[model samples]
Target: MSKIKQFFVRNKKKILIGLGVFLGLLLVAFAIFFLNRERLLQYAVKKVVQKVENRYPADLQIGKAQFKGLATVLVTDISFVPENQPKLLQIDTVEATVSVRSLFLGRLVFKQFDVANGDVTAFKQDSVDNFSFLYKKKATGEEEKTKDAKEKSNYGTILNRLIETAFENVPDGVNFRNLGVIFQNNGRTISMRLPTLTVEDGQIQGRMAITTDSITNTMYVNGVIDPDEYLLAAKMYAEKAGGIQVPYIQQKFGATMRFDTLSLSITDKVFKNDQLTITGESSAHGLVLNHPKIADEDVFVKNGALKYVITLGNHYYSLDTLSEVRVNKAVFYPQLTYETRPNRKIGVKIDSPNIPANDLFESMPPGLFDTFQGMRANGSFKYHMDFYVDMAKVDSLTFNSDLDGQNLEITQFGEQDLRKINREFEHTVYENGKPTRTFLVGPSNPNFTPYNQISNYLKNAILTAEDPRFFTHKGFHEGAFRHSLITNIKEGSFVRGGSTVAMQLVKNVYLTRKKTITRKVEEALIVWLIENLNLSTKQRMYEVYLNIIEWGPNIYGVKEGAQFYFSKRPSELTLEESMFMASIVPKPKQYRTYFNQYGELRAYPRYFFNLISGNMLKRGLISPSEHASVSSYVNLNGRAGNFIMAKPDTTQIMDTLQLAPIDLLDF
Candidate 1:
């Protein structure tokens, strides 16, 4: 061996001892770091909360943390304060048992989360509230910028990933005790006492009790929920509580309604990326209602209970369509479905037998049922409403009703009273209540003309178009009323009045123009009075009706209608011109749109002209021979036979240059 090699071999043991000391010092440093990990975590969590406060609508305060070992931690005094609210949530302490294996694997996993003594408050003051944080719409450009920042931010991603993994991995226990919630809305306060809440494995269980105005109830929610949703799964059970009274709905109609029971159960689970696929069954009972104003009206729903299932996916929820709601012996089913994808479709259906009209009408405003107050509505009815859309394009909508009120009798206003109101015509008239806006309607007015002064063809057309049974019936025409109601219900809007001449006269002369329940009721009562009390002669009523009716914009009465559409005497209007005039009476203002720039009738007006003409022929208002002549030459002649006039609609000829005289029948 060389001398250099021999000298190094002797000192090798000393060099090894120096390296061992260095490694031991490094181990001691590591032990110190492990022991103080909880403090470091606490600082980190506080800093993160401060950073999040800038983006979140609420404020968060983290508490001091202490570690039992490397994995177990106890945090004290945590709180959340919403914007404009101080301390919306307060937590006294939280002890968390964690997974050591997950820590070694660089994953945060909670074995258990035990929360003790916490209070949460939710208040909605107008549009601002404690829970509003969930609904806060981020300012423009903020969300996009945040997403971009998150993608590039490493520290933020690490912190969030760790926190999310702690809950997402299905914590062994999610339990709470003495957690309370206080809610206030619209000048009313509601308190809910949550006694015990527990979630273990896949089971969710909770119990709560509440007491409020007109309601005192205890609710229990027990179900199995998705385990991965450790944070939100517990709250699903809270949704079952019901039987709360709404002051607005009650006061608006002067009625009190009880919900009985409404318990929402969420079942099924889709934990992928925290998506929820909730479906469950629930039961409801009671639902009694009463109105103080309506005489002896009470909806005593005896053991009225209902059971239904609900499902939620995407962003919307729907109740089972086949579920039946029972009230006493009557069984009624209500169905509602809403979905949005490439399109939106909503469907609603309700059907029942012998649903007392009074039971429904009592809790509702009197205006909607004023006309039927004295009549008994018997039989069955079905209501259907639906709207559809596809590929972001609108589709045809359908809303229809089938009301069968069999054997209805309005004994109060019978034919006896009807014959009496058909007698007074020599003077002015006004609606009984609305004395303001006095409509001076007398023959002395240029547009005022008696039935005798009107053209025979016009009279025939009026009777045929408005009421075929006008001469025979009293004030009510059930067939017309039924058809009008069906049409209005189906369209989901009011387009025509199922009113008789007497009803129309009463509405125009006596009631306010505003459409309301009160006005409608008044109109019904007055129409009954006009017909039953012999308020006016039928001929006189028809004459006054022609004088006061709105024919077009700024055009009132058939006299103005005559001169406005055809600058000629009302007696000189030909069959074609009169039919044209009648076609526009229902929607005169909109009918004006029918006249294009060329002073020619539009398609709808032209169609109505032909249809009414055909109807007039069918009714024998004009002889078949006369109808042929009227139909041949009159393609809606604009004003003059020559189609002549210097300016647009300066003057109009009656389209009656050479008309064959028809057989005139006197009333």
Candidate 2:
């Protein structure tokens, strides 16, 4: 033991001396680095400028760059200009403080940042733009190799990294003065001027003046942002009393949106177990929206809020079922997921359990349910829906929806009486939003045919071609809706609508011809009330539908349609004629396209005849012999024959069978 101790004591001095020498060298190196730090920074900046200029068609310049303190940098006269384009960016002065500790850890973390007198402009003329280069990636001939790599990419990791980087770069304090962002495309220009914007002690305040074309608006924003905690809250409101109007949308996208106040907050963001979860809330008061495709009039929502929990995984993103949406007084929980691995799939689920009937009714946005105004109802209803679709097997999609009302009753009718269809009522036929004609839907009008006056063949054909389960179902056909959803998604457009006869009847009798989401929702609600409440008998509703539906140009009821095409009364129509009439119900304005120039039926209508006849035969609505006897040939003996072409043109034949033939089938 004594020998070992003596050996250790002899070697300890040399070991200590070597450690001291190494420490001294490290200190000397750090001292040299600090002494030439300014030069190193300048070199780095020069290299960055050179790299950027070489990579993009842009030029970057800096008049001066120097360090104010150990961790503070000040730069002057910074500008970026693209080739053959206007000045893209300009800055008079910029100052920022970095965290020395973070720098040692190889991270650039900001403490304080300030910018003065800067302008960022994006201009586009014809097909050229000034700012697109920022997002353009140079082709490396490896994109094809990486095309299938997206399925294996970890979304949660990427998103977490982005969030961390963004938060790290957000300074604890910021001051921006006289900053302007301008956008110009062709002849249109939009400018936003921020005279003063500041963030101090996690609180933010900003005032912006926006100008689009000749209109100017002022908006105020106040928020709290905690970068360290990944929390942010903001409120945006207009300077004036009314809602704030967003610029560029109305002119560029033909849509207008206004909101009285918009509030947004991110409560938390966390990454764990290869999954990222983010929670946030957004609310809007007095929101108004208008688009020709959405509605004719502006749709108004008094109050709406959404509390969302979003999740991201390796190959999927989801809105968790914990997310809740509040519209006026009603609340609903919604869940949605989109996956890309194995096969692309989408799943959506919504649940609103046992909500008050009045709350639901009152929650309907204004201008969407104008007829439902002043309506009072009793009892509550629960709505649930689950939909799943795998892109590889869309035909095997799963969809189920239910809106069950418990002892529901409408005690008071709204603007329109629910039971009016059972009696004589004035029904107006509109063409292009203008009232073309008005007629009585009951016994008072000479052309009005009762249920019995219409031939059973015509009724059966219309039912088979329009809504096969119209009599059995309450108001909606889930299978048809599922099919419609699938078809629309496949086509990437609204090529088919799964409207039942009841919906069509409501639309024609009480609603205008304008096609809009609002109209459709209102139509569905009305159909539900009429059918579920027994306000109108099935026979009466069918009669009304037959009396008011448009069959051809300027042709309004079954009587006019039968006479216009066949010069026969509704009760005198044959099975073949009824099928022809049913075929034209979808595109009445294009009925002439169904015939060749010789006024004979084209080949497309034959598919409809066979489909409808086959369905009828399968349902025993028609005998096998009767179905075999049915023919696709039809003769236009009425005024419709005058519109036929003088020569045969196969190209003019309308592909009506392509327009949802499965929907037309009774099955």
Candidate 3:
């Protein structure tokens, strides 16, 4: 012990000197770090801000940064709030943490992160406006309060801030923990309520998440949210206006609408239910308040009130309201069932009987329904729908509803907020008048009209012109097809089509109308399947045919042709108007010149129309006296002025079985 002590005493001076040097080096390093800390953090934050600006091009600023270790960096209060900006939005707070491992490497490696609290406020002046996060720079002398007030009140500012924090270019190969969001806008609020949020690359996952109730002030979504899986659900709603309704019917249906472009996707997990059920409804305003069957009854109300109650066996729930109706506040009750691998059955139900119909209608935004004429109706109805799902997709959905069928008094939800309504109406009018109208018509028409009326006209006209043997055949009319096929083979160039109406429907719906044997086989197979299933009749075949048939440049359907050629309704066509419309059935443009100059074609197709009508008369398709009168009235170039008709063709005529496509195209 004495010898060791003597050795230690001898080396004490050397050890002291070494220790002193080490302490000096440590002090120097810390001093250098502290002094340059501002610049270092400035460079980093500036670079990040610049990147975000380049992408989003917005007003962005990062709070002063603090570092604890060589690796741990914290940005305390970052914001992307804009001032004097019309387009850009703002956010409240954004916090970021750098991973400890990649400190000196000059690359972002985020292993753990905490985004404690944030708020987003978004706004747009109108539905037609595109949401922009960048604001225009304005004069500096602008009123400070006005500028600040605009920024503060602007919800877009909050949106921008939240986007930067949540979606900034995070480093690869890093883990995340506990990310959350809480936002509110009047009647609605969203709490991302993620107890744990993990993210790596493009993959994101969350646990114990909840989406609060939008209408009845309840939480609609509560469970683990896998961005990848829940994304699909989000996508379904994103594309469609009304996402999904749980309860079949209530006082009013609740739904969300998208008037602008937005995209969302699932990240990692899927939507599931320990016990699951879904209900949905789609009703137009006319169906709700103006159907002829219920039009005359008490519809408009000075005092609008609605109420509903449901009793599922023993459980019961009730809803009440006293005003206009919004289309989404219905409740959904799920009956959940389970099954084992081989063959087992288990059933479960989630039920809600109390749905407030009046409350739903009253919750509608001002001016949703601006005005009404003698409309009065207020009552509550209840409906139930159950879904049977095996694994994922629905197996069956059974819907049942009891419409209270009460005398309802209807009135505008909002007093004549005419300014908004007029603006919308004017925009729609301008859009319809634009050259874009041609785009709407397209090569095939999407004309909105009853399917039955158009079908009857096209069928009779086709049979009057083409083949009379359309209905008796399977996919092909054996006698007519054989005869036409022989003639086409002899001619070397195709002059006629033996295609039946069924074949035409098949070709139009399932396959392209290519004049080739391969396409023909496909068309035939589709036709065979449609016929074999016995799903459609000859009249239905014609309806489908006219819907997809090309009538002219950017025109389709018999109704469209009737309007385009005659400027009249299909039912209002006179005998000559009918014949003139039918004359072009073979080739719409081939005979368009006949009517382009007010029915001026004094030549070929008209002569054929008369011949075909004459043959039909001989075949008892039309009365002789009627045929004689129609023939006498024919002025191939005749104007159908003041030609009011008695009745449109009916289904009985469609079922006559003699009219065929061959007869229509033959002439």
Summarize candidate 3's per-residue lDDT along 357-458 as a digit string, tens digits. 354344332222212212222554343433232332222222222222223333333332212211111111112223322212122334634444553434
Q: Which ten-residue region of model 1 has the weakest summed lDDT?
A: 656-665
What are the per-residue Cα lDDT tens digits for candidate 2 across 377-485? Answer: 9998788989999999987888988878889999988788888988899988887899988888878889888888888889999888888887889988888888888
Q: What is the lDDT of residue 570 in candidate 2?
A: 93
TM-score of each: 0.43, 0.78, 0.32
- For model 2, the local distance difference test gives 0.83
**lDDT tens digits by residue: candidate 1, 1-667:** 9988887799889878989999999889668768756555665566657665876778888667677665677878988887777568898988888664444444445788888898887788797677645423345597866754443323223323443554455567778888888788866777777788777876778777765554545656565645344323222222333344434446468777655454444333333332233334444344445564432244444345454544444433455665666644445667666666535666666666555543433333223334333443333323333333232333234444344333333345321233322443332333333433334566445556778988877776766666656666676665565455444445557655666666677766644455554455456555644554455667777777777777665567777777766786789899877877665555565544555456566555555555556767777676778766754223333332233222343333222111101111121
**Best candidate (score: TM-score):** 2
Query: What ranking emerges by lDDT with the best candidate at the front?
Result: 2, 1, 3
In the order shown, what is each candidate's alpha-carbon RMSD?
A: 16.2, 7.6, 22.3
Error of 1 at 9 (Å): 40
**Every candidate's lDDT:** 0.56, 0.83, 0.43
Q: TM-score of the candidate numbered 2?
A: 0.78
**Stretch of 10 with least lDDT, candidate 3:** 421-430
